[model samples]
Target chain A: MIDVQLIGLLNATLQAATLLFIAALGELITEKSGILNLGVEGMISVGAVSGFITAINTENLFLAVIVGVLSASAFSSIHAFVTVVLKQDQTVSGLILTILGLSLSSLIGKPYVGKKLEVKLESLIDIEEPLNIFQVLLNQNLIFYIAILLMIFTAYVLKKTMFGRRIEAIGEDLKSADSMGLKIAKTQFIATCVGGAFAGLSGVYLTLSYVPYWTDGMTSGRGWIALALVIFGGWKPYRTAFGALLFGFLEALGPRLQTYGFEMSPYIVKITPYIITILVLVFLTIIKNGNTGAPKNIGIPFFRENR
Target chain B: MNKFILSKKLYRNELATFYSFLIGFLIALAVGSLILFIQEKNPFDVFSLMLKLSIGSVNSLSNSLNKAIPLILAGLGISIINSVKLWNIGAEGQIFMGAIALNFVYINTSINNSQIYIFLLLVSGFLGGAFCILFPAVAKVLFGVNEIITTLLTNYIVFGLTIYLINGAWKDPASLNFPAAAYVSESVYLPTVIGKLSSGFLICILFTLIAYYIKDKSVFGYEMRIAGGSALTAIYAGINAKQKAFFAMLIGGGFAGLAGAIELLSQTHRVSTGISQGFGYTAIIVAAITGMRPVGIFLVGCLFGALTIGGSVIQTIGVSSYIAEIIQATTLFGALIAQFFFSYEILKKSEND
Candidate 1:
């Protein structure tokens, strides 16, 4: 018989994994369109701050999330303009964006510190008493379901669509894609914007559900982990979600282990996710020659130069 | 009617750069004003206050320079690695490791000579910073891993380990509640040169000068330029791209480590998690604004240093330092756009073959 603590651990895993999975999937789409966005962290920061402000002022969860996506995408558009149109270095722009985002959010969250939510995000599914496996799986915050739905939708869109093929072509060989009449610039811009939207939603989840309070720098490297998950997932949505779940499980280990009488140091437990990420990347590199599955022109900005 | 058409410039004159920075600063000011307006604060008042706070007196000026010590050092590292087109995003973690290294040396080794002990601590800082990036740098060189992800992930590990040390192993008993390591022996503290600025600021300048020489006046620097421009060109030119990559990361990481050591030895005098204060991130922006020019980094590092203090100035009136961040980011974007214009001019449309 499965223990209640095990079920509780699994539940915590779903909540933790949901936000990360959403962010990774968004990044996967952005990368698929041939741009390696290093600014997801920044976008999330902007989203979280804006989302928190929106939540507090309007007391509308959905509007708050919408604002979150919009603010995040607004910041990302600047990156797109710089890297895409200006052909500036993507990695540098991404770093600056993170600094800007974190700083901006810190400023925004300063006033809202220790502020509690006036309204809680209501769950989409309501079930009480005698919870079976189905009930257990179904009973979660609304954002959790949205994340699972998004994962499936993204995986479907990536695998079985003409748009997907266009992105794949652009990522692999932008010159060839341009020759074949693909809208490289437009597609990349839109993809990055869409990615930014989901990144915003990820931040919204953090403020509304995960941590559920306004705190400065609360995203706290979750954005970076999401970026790593994109790599470990090989830029595939379902795999990215799987990576998120595993990371979440590791994250939930502190509480779960405590229940099992392990009593590990929380700080040490906090680092397990990053340590695993580094080990996995190293191992993947050392294994040698099975296809890293990275987009070919991901970091190289596309320019309309007739060479 | 005239239409913009980009034309490549044969040689970039100094006028273009001057114009670009002027325009960049203007744009940043404009963006900052917008943010201030949203916050219901007077933009002019806050900006002027920030300026006053940064350089209103000798003590404050020295304070700004002291804070810029880490950024200048870290900026040099960013500029070096950037020459080889490598992203040095792990400077924050490297900075933390540098502090850890200095504390490790101070706690474990008993060196009485202040000069010699400080020198050794500096080396340890460099090693710690370099050590943090070595594994990832090797991975990037050998396995084709993206340095951005690898470097970034290492920051978390470094942070966790640092917190673990300060809270668990190296926790000071006397400091009742604060999670800081045992203070470095007072003999190890460097003498302050300016009002509050330590000799570390001078060390940062010296390192920047050394970096400038390596970047502008060395064969290895030339090789790094070639590799950054085109890997194929570098390989064909027999530049040994792998070695350049490794050297770039090591040198860059070392500079950041030195910054960490500077902090520990200069002011903080103790290893703590707040040592970096995002200097690693800010230095990347500084490097980008100057387009990795060694000289430009020095000037911009000072400007950013002022802004770093400016970030706190507004906090007195219940304003967030985010304005500083916003202004810095906007200025970087503006400068980048100007750089783009410098390289490719938008000429009036004309029929040409």
Candidate 2:
């Protein structure tokens, strides 16, 4: 019975960690390319709404997830355009996007409120075999496996590849990189868009695999946690996966503890992820002596010439 | 020839801002029209109806003015900090704490003594907001934690704390099952000064003047500009960056708190979660769009206030209130894009540069 309980708890933890992992990966890429995309929450909401609505209408989980990713990326592109191309304050632009996304999603998703759907993924290789921990962990919807693989791929690309070097060079010092024949604008723009695409995909994964249903503000605060995970991971893909897992464990443990007859205010338990973020941020602060190895040009707008 | 070059540059920059604003307006109109179009209604008719409802009558005009009151104050707070390059995202939280503090005074003590109570309430709100900066201020000053993170994090903490209190200790008993505090007495209410216009409008104007005075004429203001424009230069000139950031955030928090107080006492007449209503967040955009200048903040605030109030008027035509939000978002996007022109010239090709 104890072993069974442990398995259930670990499964819940892995399930809960998927959204944050996807989002943190997205943010990690953007930050690596020297931009702070604060619109993750907004993009998540947009994806949730889009994914939920598409899935409900067609009753096709695959199509719904695709729609979710596209919608979130499209929404995030607007953020990229405003902050990157237009040279606005990324923080303010992001806050506005959050409000816009939340309000817009709520208004549009009103029709589909309370409607539920069970996601039926296309059959895969026999993965859900009973009692094997590896199979149990890997038996999640295809997106969960994809998320882990993407993290590994991202780690390899960022650490080993030449493209990764250029991205790092640009983020470290755009002026120096420009002098070295790097296309600063094009590189940053692509990084931001790709980051946005992954962010949207995270939201799609949330709606399709984890929640498997539609609701307004469904992925509440998960985006913020994902953002914190990027910081906790110190901007490395592998470390970010670890941070996501920790967050997922905390979130899953909260409800499970209640289920096991532990008495605690759900509100207090809900604050666990935020409290952990604070602690991790403090730890990272100590590690960096306050600098935290931030991208040199990370929130600063780059102008081609001196005006 | 040099003068001509400068003039050309200025025109290009101005034109960018103008185009951004124009595009924002077009987007707003398109969104409004899209909503109507989707509803199978005539877009033109719905828009006209919105105009008629928002400013078409004295009642609606009063409503718009009331809405403008808190926005103008919050906009000023946003404007000041942006000038110093400090990201004070804690405004909403500051405002919430301010409202909570003001209510404590208004409810616990009898304001029936004199008109001084109003002044006291205003001061308390300002102080309350300033107080909310305690933890984050310490974090930034001592540890160099990005004020952005601390300030934003505090907002959720304060919001959660407020909800916890309201649901537990502060729940009104005389009322029905709703979670609310007691309605404040009339003596504490801000009096109406004009034909249905409350004194909140006058407070907004007065605060605007004070902010303008401090920003443009004060010696302290000059130091703040120096610090914001060039931290290295300011440090060389003997200005402490930590102290400057602290002072800017303190004032910013206070002004936002004052907005919360005004919102509570003058408009809502009770404390609730809806009091902030993105006003603190949107105020940042208002400040940015106006280039962080006091006069510009006032104008921008009025424009947005008109848009918000006008949006409600058009709601009778089955248009969602989110149309206002779309307008706000697009306008902010436009303004930020416009700001890029001030720093860089957009050439037809990279080779031109």
Candidate 3:
């Protein structure tokens, strides 16, 4: 019985972590490129609604995911145009994007509220027999496995590739990178779009697999948590994945604790993750003494003439 | 062949903000009209009805003012912090915390004097908001932590606490199956001047005037401006930049808290999760559009308030109330583009010049 419960908890944690890691990793990429796109929530909303709508109409999971990703990327291009091309404030633009995304999603999604899609993504392995611990962990949806692979891919791209070096160079010092002939605006624009795509993917997973039904504002505050996770991870890919898992564990622990007859308000349990995020940030800041691994030009718009 | 280049202006254009806001407002209306047209609704008729419902009558205008009270206060709070180059994105949470604190004090105390009870609630509300931001302010000053994330994270925590209290402890006993607190005594309720317009409007205006004076004509404001512009320059000028920033954050939080308190006493008179309808977030746009000028915040807040009221009214015609938010968001974008144009002039020049 204990073994089964433990496995169940672990599976839940992994599911939650998958969502966070995908979104945070995307945000991590954008921040690394020195473009702070705070519209993760907005992108996620657009992705979720569009993906859910497409899934219901076509009943094809693959096409739905593609549509979701493409829609979110298109939505994020607005941020790129406003902040990168026009050189406006990234923070304000991102916030507006969030407002626009949420409102627009609700407007578009009003007709589909409470609607469920018949088609669902199946697990990678469908073993019916009593499974071992390894099998229990491995028997997850295709998106779960995809999330892991994406993490690895992101780590390699950011660490090993020449393009990765250029992104970091642009993030660290815009003038120096521009002098080096790096296409600052184009790189940032692409990075922002990629981040939006990831956010959309995470949202698609939420509606398609996690909930399997359409609900207004279903992404809740996960996008914000993912944003914090990037900071908690110190802007590193592997560290971000680890942070996502830890948060997932905390999120999963609350309901499990209640089932085990623990007398605790669910709200208090819900509040734990946010409190821990702040505490961890404080601890990280104190120990590192201000080297939080943030890109120096993270929020500043790159202007070639000014440089 | 001729090309255009952006040349930075030598002096700041004072009328840029005015023109930018005008352009932004017009652009938002255009976008809203397009959406309405797409929905097969007559844009002109819908817009005229929206304006009529929101501000056509004195009573509706007063209703808009009542709604604008908290917005004005919250905008003032955000403007204060922005002046010091700090972001207090947690104003939403701070508003909730302030309400919680005010309600807690009201429940615990046995004070019967209406004036004292009101004053105490106001003070507690301010303190609660200040407390909400205290951690982020200290973290930013001491450890150089990014206050934006910290402040934002706290909002969720406060929201969770609000839900817990509403469901568990503060749930009204007399009201069956409802998750809300008991209403405060009627005596302590803020007196309404005209229609639903409470004395809270007066309080908001007073604070706005005070903030304007402090920001423009005070020595502390001068220090804050210098500190925000450049820490090294502030240090050279014998100013404690960190301290100024810290105080600015606290004052900002205090204004949000005061807004919460006024909201409670004047509007709801009971604690619930729906007390703040994104007033804090909307205030950020208000402050940004007005460049943090207290008077401008007041004007913009009332305009947004009218939009919100108009949005709800249009629902009778089968339009989604989300139209208000859509317009608000677009307005920000429009203002951004206008500001860009105002700051950088596009000059036509010969390629070989």
Tell me each candidate's TM-score.
0.95, 0.90, 0.96
Clashes of each: 0, 0, 0
Question: What is the C-alpha lDDT profile of model 3 across A1-307, one tens digit per residue?
Answer: 4376777888788888998889999999999999998889889999999999999999999999999989998999999998998888998888778878988999889889988689987677875632466776668888898898999998999889998988899999999998898989899999999999999999899889888887777877788889889988999999999999999998778778977789888789888878887888898889988888899999998875621
What's the distance in Å from true for residue B182, model 3?
0.2
| lDDT, candidates in the order shown | 0.84, 0.76, 0.88
Residue B70, model 2: Cα distance from true site in angstroms: 2.5
lDDT of 2 by residue, B78-155 (tens): 667765777777787888988988888876776556478888988889988888876677677777666666676667
For B84-126, candidate 1 gives per-residue lDDT tens digits of 8888888899999999998888888987788999999999999
Candidate maximizing lDDT: 3
The candidate, 1 or 2, that scores higher on TM-score is 1
Better of 1 and 3 by lDDT: 3
**Candidate 2 chain A minimal-lDDT segment of 10 residues:** A122-131
Write model 2 residue lDDT over A1-307, tens digit each, in one string.
3366677778778878878898889888888888888778888888888988888889887788788888888888877787766767778788777777877887788778787765555324455433556756656778788888999899988889989888889889988997898877677777887777787788877766677666766766677778778877888988889988888888889877877889876656666666667666766786688877778889887765533
Instruction: Give candidates' CA RMSD values in order.
Output: 2.4, 3.9, 1.9
